[model samples]
Target: MDDWVDPGETLETASFERLYRGALELASSVERTRAATLVLLTGRLGLTLEEALHCNEGWVDWERAELQVPEKDPCACAGCWELARRRREHTDPIREVLYEECWSPSPDRAPRTVPFGWSRRISAALLATADRYLLDLLPGDARELLRAAGEAADGIEPDDLTPGLLAATTVDFLSDLGLEADGTAAVLGVGEARVEPYAAAGESDVTTRMARLAGVDGSADPESAFPVACGTEAFESEPFDVGAADADALAERATATDAPERVPRPTDLPASVDYDPADHAAAGGPNRRTDAGSWAEGPSAADGNENALRADGASAVTGADRGRAGLPDDPSTASGSQATAPDVTCARDVVTQPVVADFSTRAAADGLCGGREIPGRVILGQEELFVLWSEEKGAEDADAPHLLVPLEDVWDVRIDDVPGRLSASFPHAVTVGHRPSGRDELAVSIQLPPAQRRDMASALYRILLNVTPMTVVDPAREGGRVTDADPEEMVLYVRPHGVAFTDEAGDAARLAFDLSDVVDVERIERSFDGESRPAVQLRRVTDNRPVTTVVTAADDRLRRLVWRYVRREYHQTLATVRGIRLSDAEKMVMVALYSTDGTPDLGSLLDLTEQELSAALQSLAAKELVRSAEAATDLTGTGQLAVSDRLESVNH
Candidate 1:
């Protein structure tokens, strides 16, 4: 509590996002902030949470051997001096801002500060790397998409721009890809000279592309090398929309699959044979023959009618009709003459293989879940869909999932609208939840631009259908992250019912939670295969002094099994004690106390009214998750009974 004041008190805490913006505003100078931020963000000189909160130009001298904090008072009791906490605050919001955007985690123990927002001063190289990461996350042939965009954009480097700019530029490039030199110039608002360079540079092959990625110079000849591995024709990244032609294509594919019948292609000739060239010539001379004989005997009345019919037929053969026939509207005007099919990949599979196949009817695992996927991965292997999502911290990392969930276990996927918006620009969110374990439920939110929601959802649906569990659960295996082991030894593997481990005797042991004594699950970092797999550490209610045993992350799944078991047990214990879901007010109060080092006076800190506080306390008391009245009743001055015996595990 030494010289700390909560910034939330003076500055409004209505929207937590503001806290991040405010930090950058108070960062003193933009350039200093950008540079120090990059260092802190990149985890080069790893600073702890305490250090990051108090960091300033004076605080962190990365070049110095010893990390130093000058003797001067860092907080002015309301002064501008950088301080850990002008008031007690939780670091989650701040951490969320930095890591999700620019900060890359380091394998080492030293903590680092991460900011959520950005300014243009951020180096171009860093922006490129970040954009690459985003593109990597998108499902599909990312390389092909990149190459196609580069070709369309002429010579602009794909990685030269930030993610936002890259996305916009890609849309333009793909749309203008087949345009003629003149059309491309018109679309790009540039001269034909610029279009030539883009077109000339467009044909780089895959080998040269890889060379470029490796920092090699000179473009690869398109004929010499192949385009990106996705087979260069390219898949447009835009979400799908259905059209009549697409519907017919789907039907054709279906018919072929069912009966392998050959389908006929439409004729190159006009559909209507009503046109008479002689009549057309007499009417408008459009049907005039090249022969000298035709000139000698001018078109007769019948010839005039034929000429008019030809004109009418030509009109019907262009525009919409041409599109339906998959032909150019005007053969001479169509650019490049290298046009491939309109990128129909998204729309092709969308309608037939929708997330929920036959939504008007029921199908097994047929429902679609569309939302912003959480950070965790869905490893879809041969036989299973192992779903994992988490913030990968203490308890969260432990309960993460790894093994297969039976196909039938996945059910109850429901989509609900989340009303309201933080700003005019931000779209209203929609939440999607699915029960992958039959018993356990997980949910995610989609907050994309309104126009892009359906497309994103379609992409997500395809991914969900394809995902598999990281590894099949096998008891004989050395690594099985979730262990429901026997009671005596250390838990090294997570079982369906308990955890397994090696004891002090160097013998295998197992332990199942009574669902009472376990306090919290903390992920302890350990190295494996030159990579670090976070191991789980348990905190118990029995003895605070003794250190607990670690449950290792075994197998291919990243700490999912251990994380899931620990968290599920923790929640089950609370549910047993509380008997129902905690209200928003109750959860907030618990979080507030937890954030403030488990102290009383939570209502004032959270800016909750007395009535709200009373109701929340009542719920906490009924659930037996907290002693609301105990702190108020305390005769000697001390913090309130902030959390219950079971709930205390969550706080840790």
Candidate 2:
């Protein structure tokens, strides 16, 4: 065979149009059926050589204006058998790991139905040439005819002529004429057709030929005609202007490369405000002495006659102590002054203040690390929850050691009201379950003040709602009437990762199911007390054992709700390909696979080469629409949904 020109390579629009018109005109030299086959193969119908060859008269539906491509039995060729053997070998290890049966022994192919309209040109061609076996119309001289056609148009030999090349050329021509895939399909009386990736640009001589033939202006705007080629040049040619003063400033800044000796002060800093002693006292400063007498009035006051010196602002106070207390120097006690001195408060004096909780108490001591009984205050920050604790009691120190837990690490939370008998001061108990980095699951319990319990719970709940992907459904709010069979009231939460059944209050999680483990969901009826109640049954596979859960409700709508949401989640999780744009070949393969039953031999059925089919399958797998090509070749739940949505659009 001669070296075949790659159909995916770029072709000039003018050349493509010339070759296409030449092929149609040269159809007269061949048999009637052979000529019709060539036209059909090169048109917007997107047919493969094998499919066009296999087509028969029975495929057409005149009344419905439709065409049906009947399914073919599995090919027993040596190539197919070798391909199957390689697949089985590759999937054997995977089957062992999953411990489940994967592939079916034999699969059946499903026929595809496409919309077709009756037009004068197409009707006449089909009526004159269509037969029981269309391939019979083509003789061994077909290659000679293709060579003659190519030479007449672009001086190319028969080696360059192929079904893919012809189809790609025709699709590109139609696209340049302002007809999209759907529009082209309508005009040609075929299913969906799309322009190939490499044929997107209409810059070549082929485009000029096509323009002349179609009566379109060939000298239209270059940017619109060739966006990929002219985009950067157009952008670079745009004018930009700068003012003289701005340019001078920019140049000055660029030239000043020398390092300054000292950093310049920011001009935007605010001026200092005068200090007020009364305001400082109200803000918990050292000046206002309470019933607790100041050390200046103690017995040491006389020894510090010494006290007289301190009163006169002559006492030696260390700068470190003032800094530790976050205090400013007293203006009244300046040097050479006789004003009364304010009492000084040291770090030790500040440490003696009482805290909100008594850390030494037995109840508070039980919540720390393995009963080590350290004293601490639990502080909930915006992103993390932490406990600040110190060995010394009665101290609220910011420098104390603490344990930080990011809110995301917390997976479960339990809140309960502490009985009065346990501890009257600490009335609310909150336990948080978390798994920290490289650590096993652990629980931390804390007692909250009576007044702060509601606020703390509300904040934690808000954080959980924002971070966790969950949809809470209240049975009562959704008009569900609970039956006696399920006496315990429960709430249903549908989540992307899983589902959970909680108590009616939505606080306690009673049961949970991961989405992956769920195999099926259906509606069933359960009898209790001589009455049948509608119920939804969830079937899951866990630990190689089947487990079933049936939730009963008085009304059938409740069952429907559960079934609908579960199915919807399954479809959504598997069908991530939805709403995503696919390539032309990928879309066609997806539709073909969806229209089939079981794991049919798509390569043979669609008449696709092994490489072409493999490429399409790999692309679909990357988008998560199917398993890898080496695995069972079938459309996943997501793939099916994607094809269904496409068909729905076509129908509309």
Candidate 3:
């Protein structure tokens, strides 16, 4: 029964609370390397992989072009620059430098370059490192928890912040890691200012207050306009005193419910017993008698004996009132005041009931709801509900409407627990719908900002998986081994996976290896199966033509055929446009345009760079058709060609 209860319930209801916290810290070292690589590729080489991969070596003929590629140079191609190997060299040490520099007060004294370019790369790397660190700090059952969180945070804007999310993530991380409660709480409180702004904006005062109760430091600088629609803390803190007292007084004030009168009136006080004024004078001195006579002179005072009783009772009542005035107001006092005045906003549930309750009850009655009887409401046509909820759930961990409800009420919930769903941020995608199909039910979805999602997932998944790329050389592979060896005759080359490298020497006919032949297995404490990309190979058959036969190593043709099918499905296009490794495509397009001209060809088109034209001409000459000559033409030849074209058009 205890295990069956929701963890949140246990956390809130139990006398003691325990949260799992992560020991790992978040950083962006891994991301920095990728960014750096992209920068170098685009900035230095002027190439975009999106377009350059379209031209293969054969497609880039260089006979008439000036770009040179020595046949014997193995390291002289654009695709074989060894970016991952280079990245490893650039990152590991630099990350340590950055970490130390950040910790140091004197940043200027830091031992490395901190340029804008460096910062971008570093930020990217830090983001990646932080994700892995977070995963290590989460629990094994973190998936369910994170999914619930994401669902809770659905529809939230990336910029919206809330303290509920911060506390939730903190508590969840601590609980997942099985950390010491005190230590977890302390850590949760640490950096509250930094985390709170990213998590607490746009939330209700109650929810924000609750977050503060949990030690969240920051407050919404500018409070939200629709605070009621905010998260639980505010909803939970809905005052039940004088404002809500109206509901109880509903029967007393109006002939509403059948309940008995609950509101107390001042007139309901007991009447004082009649007494003689002579008794006050006889018991006390002249001072007491004089005070009694003064009171007796008032209009409310009755005849002699009654006036004496009223004066004595008034003195007694005033003394009691003085004692009460000294005592602080408690719940009872608060209730007493409401009982007399019955202020609707004072905690009276007078006219309006909790909107959530109405929604829940209506939904349950219509089979549209299931959850604890929380007294709150979701206004119809309120678009900000999701944003408010996400702010509560923390940007990353928040899910959609379903997570806020009891898990039992929901038939099915879908979540993506994996990292990188939103680019290294574990922004889990969540959706809830009735049955397998239901038109009557409401379905909502959201893409959590990449950073927030990653943070949440890391907080949930306690297991950290490291991704380190390595370059390996295999002797038996066709594209030649990645070894410290001399250049040899090879038809194709293979580039390292997930890294961008440009050939240094710029050689055509350079041997490039396939994505296969080299394994990029993740070393996850040797506990998990490593993931790999689809493999491919390039080969030239006996027919004197290049045919890329994606064959199996075991000589199993049928299995190879099946693999081809799978690969085709995975890769989709076999036109070889996706895998080419080059710097610029405009050069190729320019050369192709020039190829249409005859005779000196007026040189190549103006748009092409020397590199693309050179590479292409080399490939064309290899095919033995296109030729080039240095036929320097004067201005007269250019003019004559322009005039000749115009005359030809007129004659037509």
lDDT of each: 0.29, 0.40, 0.22
Best by lDDT: 2
TM-score for candidate 1, please give it.
Answer: 0.20
Q: TM-score per candidate, in order?
A: 0.20, 0.22, 0.15
Query: 91-155 in candidate 1: lDDT tens per residue?
Result: 53322222122111122222212111111111221222221221111112322333333334433
Candidate 3: deviation at residue 9, Å?
34
Query: Tens digits of per-residue lDDT for model 3 on 1-652?
Result: 0011222422221111111101011123332222222222222121222111111121111111001111111111122222212444543542232112211111111111111111112122222322232111112122223223223333422122122332343343234323334333333323333223223232222211322322223333212311211111212211112122211122122122122111111111113412121121111111100000111111111122111111111111111122322322223211111122222222212112111111110011112223211112221110011111212111222222222222112232223221111111111223332321333533322222222222222211110000101121222233333323322221111111111111222123222333221121111111112423233332321111122322221112222322332232223122122222223442343234333333333335445457655565555444322344454211111122222223333222
Candidate 2: regions farther than 4 A off: 1-17, 20-33, 73-119, 131-144, 154-156, 177-652
RMSD of each candidate relative to the true structure = 31.2, 34.6, 40.4
Sort the predicted structures by lDDT, highest score first: 2, 1, 3
What is the Cα-based lDDT of residue 534 in candidate 1?
Answer: 64
